[model samples]
Target: MRLEDLLPSPEPVRFVAADGTETPAPAGHVRPSDELLVEAHRRMVLGRRFDTQATALTKQGRLAVYPSSRGQEACQIAAVLALRDDDWLFPTYRDSVALVARGLDPAEVLTLLRGDWHCGYDPAAVKVAPQCTPLATQTIHAVGLAEALRRKGEDGVVLALIGDGGTSEGDFHEALNFAAVRRAPVVFFIQNNGYAISVPLAQQTAAPALAYKGVGYGVVSEQVDGNDLLAVLSVLTTAVQHARSGRGPYLVEAHTYRMEAHTNADDATRYRDEAEVTRWAAADPLARLQTYLRHRGLIDDEAVRTAEDEAEAFAAEVRTKLNADVVADPRTLFDHVFAEPTAQLVEQRAQLVAELDAGEA
Candidate 1:
């Protein structure tokens, strides 16, 4: 089939307006239950609190660096909640919110950000890849893992997360092409938060939408309101179901905004106007979902207070754990890279050990 024939219109799928009013989903799509919506809201609130704490830690030098997903909680929470426990998630540095929501310990998730190790937790234990630092490299890993699952007759799918900046990487294109051709059970989720670091989306690409890139590879693609928790959950649920059913890979572009700077290291004001940030602040994901639930009588003042209390408790736990000093084992540097250490690596390890011994002496 020609690429044009497989391409769908770039219209976004949304089930809730910014004002918290219900909107009609496309045909065959049903609105989620109030129970599920409440659960999703709880996760989003926790994610917001987690992001806030992590950013504060960066400021206090408790964390080396942090990329806060302040306004994008809905996208992070919904993506993980939509998946089964057996499914794998490949996250980027900014996806700590998603990782936390997926049952990873908050301290473990921040281990790498704390500058202790490359990976804080085992990928095999939690079915989550190490939070990738290099741009778009995880996409290829996700595709390869999904293809391997298919070969092994395993019942699983992979959700690969990337940022707007990552979409520009060559690995992004290659991974998408390979997945589409191989019919890999993987979903490439691009969180387009309007800027690639300081560079605006207009500067990123002239394509109608990032999801359109999936169409070029003959992969099914959809766009959704990243701020709307319900909409993001619905869209991701459908995509995951499609992949699990042996359909080709899917691409989802989440239209969201980064409320904070790209990282604690960036000054967003250099590139974006305060007025634009103010506009997105008004559409804050956590507030929108809370408003929707309140309007539906699914959430009351008491429930809101309970959620807040829970978030506070989580933040406290993260703070206490992160404030503790971490001891580094120098030997770990030589571990896990290869079954047998290379001669050069052995030499480097010995030199480091001798230097440490001399200093101690």
Candidate 2:
């Protein structure tokens, strides 16, 4: 391709207006099918409910911390739904919503945050990396994994999910550079939720758009209206196809918002005014998509009701599981750390086993 083709447009790729009207998209950017959109809508609904349940659990002392993705449902769900099951997902700590949308058990998705043990689910089994906490670090891991997959002649594409603030990290830059140079099959999906903790986007980076950051690395990039599910799904579908075809890595920056504070521990009122929150709420992803589908007659009242019921049921199941007593084996600490246990780990496991035996005696 050409150098000019690597640059992202200043305006975000959009298909649905904020008011639920269908808009025209650029020629090559195909709108996702109706069936996919409806399924995406249901998952988006379920994802938001899951996020709410997790936050409530945090407040009830059932969880340690929850970085809610309340307003970013479209980005969270669309990112996972766009990929094939064989494709890999590298998620950030706040991406539990995305993890659940990817069909991971909610309880297992929260294991790390709950402080129960290491990654609750096997990364290899599900194609999802452990939910990473440090900013932009997962991008490097995603790139490395993508390169390994490429070297092994696998068809899997990797998508690394990040927040806007993570773009400032050195790892994020390094990953983009390496992936671009090596033509790795990775897509960097940035959820520009307007803040890194209390820091707003304005304070984070002066770049016209985070998508533009990929240009210097020669990675093709795109910006999308993240609140519009149709737009997000469309852009990501194209990005994944571009990477899977061996063209190189792609970068996507979704312009979205975080309605809730950074986490339950954060005081959002100190940094942002209610007026800004109210404005974004007017463009809520769930409300917008539901309106669009209803207008198109794609989903009827019964369909909407069924989706709500499913979401409620999903939340209830998560709550029940989290409330139940946990049975954990201390020996698991030494497991999953390596494919083959090192001598030191073997020695440490023996010492722990002896201590447990003595305590029981």
Candidate 3:
């Protein structure tokens, strides 16, 4: 496709309106199946509740910090639901919800944020990178993995998730250029939630949208209504396929909002007012999706209850595990530092063990 043809639509694609009604579809945009929508609704309900519980945990001091993906649940869940089990997921720190949706243990997902361990779960086992906190760095890692998969003739693609703020990072650009040139089977999913912590999009870049950046890098790109789950899933499903089909890389910019402060430590009131928050909340992803599902007779009270029950159970387990004391071996710090221990490292490890032995004696 021509670069211009690959450029995202001037307006974001949407299938569900903010008011719980269906909207007219644009050319090339198709409604996701009812089966998919129903499944998404269930997971989204679980995801939103999980997000709330995580935020509560931070307040209760169980976690060192938490970046809640409250309003961005649509983006968070769709990014995962769009992918196959074999596909790899690269998530940002704010993507614990996505990690959970991908069937990761919630407590394990928060391990890095809790300052307990480097990675609580095995990335290779699940094909999920640790939830990244260093901005667009995951994008580069995803590209490298995608290239490796290509070289190995594996039928896999990588979905590298980032935020609008991450687009400004040099790593994000480098990854895009490399992926485009190498035709790496990777998709860069950017949830443009209107802020890079305190800085607004206006101060960040003059580009029409983040997806446009991909076009310049020779990657197919599109923008979707991030607040609309159907729209996000539709756009992302197509993007993933495009890359899987050897079309190089695809970038999707989802226009969404951050309903909470950057982290538990941030005071959002300092930068944005209540009116702005209220305005965005009016377009809440969960509410809109639920509305559409109910209107279509896809979900009823029983299904709602089922999702709530599951979410509560999920939250309870996370609370129980995280609140309990953890026992970790100090030797693990030395174990993975190198495949073959350097002489200095071995000596340091011996010294540490000796010190522990002396204390016991």
Q: Give TM-scores for every candidate, taking all chains together and pairing residue i with residue i.
A: 0.95, 0.97, 0.98
Cα lDDT tens digits for candidate 3, 6-73: 78899999998998899988679778899988888889988988889888888888888999889999
Question: lDDT per residue, candidate 1, 98-176, as tens digits?
Answer: 9999999999999999988888898999999999999999999999999999889987999999999999999999999
What CA RMSD would you report for each candidate? 1.9, 1.2, 1.1
Give me the displacement of residue 274 in model 1, in angstroms. 1.1
Off by over 4 Å in 1: 1-10, 343-361
What is the RMSD of candidate 3? 1.1
lDDT of candidate model 1 versus the reference: 0.90
lDDT of 2 by residue, 1-361 (tens): 6878988876998888888988877667888899999999899889988988999999899998889999899999999888999999999999998999888999999988888965889899999998899999999999999999999999899999999999989999999999999999999999999988988888988899999999998999999899999989989999999999999999999999999999899999999999999999999999999999999999989998899999999999999999987888899888878989999999999999999999999
lDDT of each: 0.90, 0.92, 0.91
Lowest lDDT sum, 10 consecutive residues, model 3, at 1-10
Each prediction's total of clashing residue pairs, residues at least 3 apart in sequence or on different chains, is 0, 0, 0
For model 2, which pairs clash?
none
Off by over 4 Å in 3: none
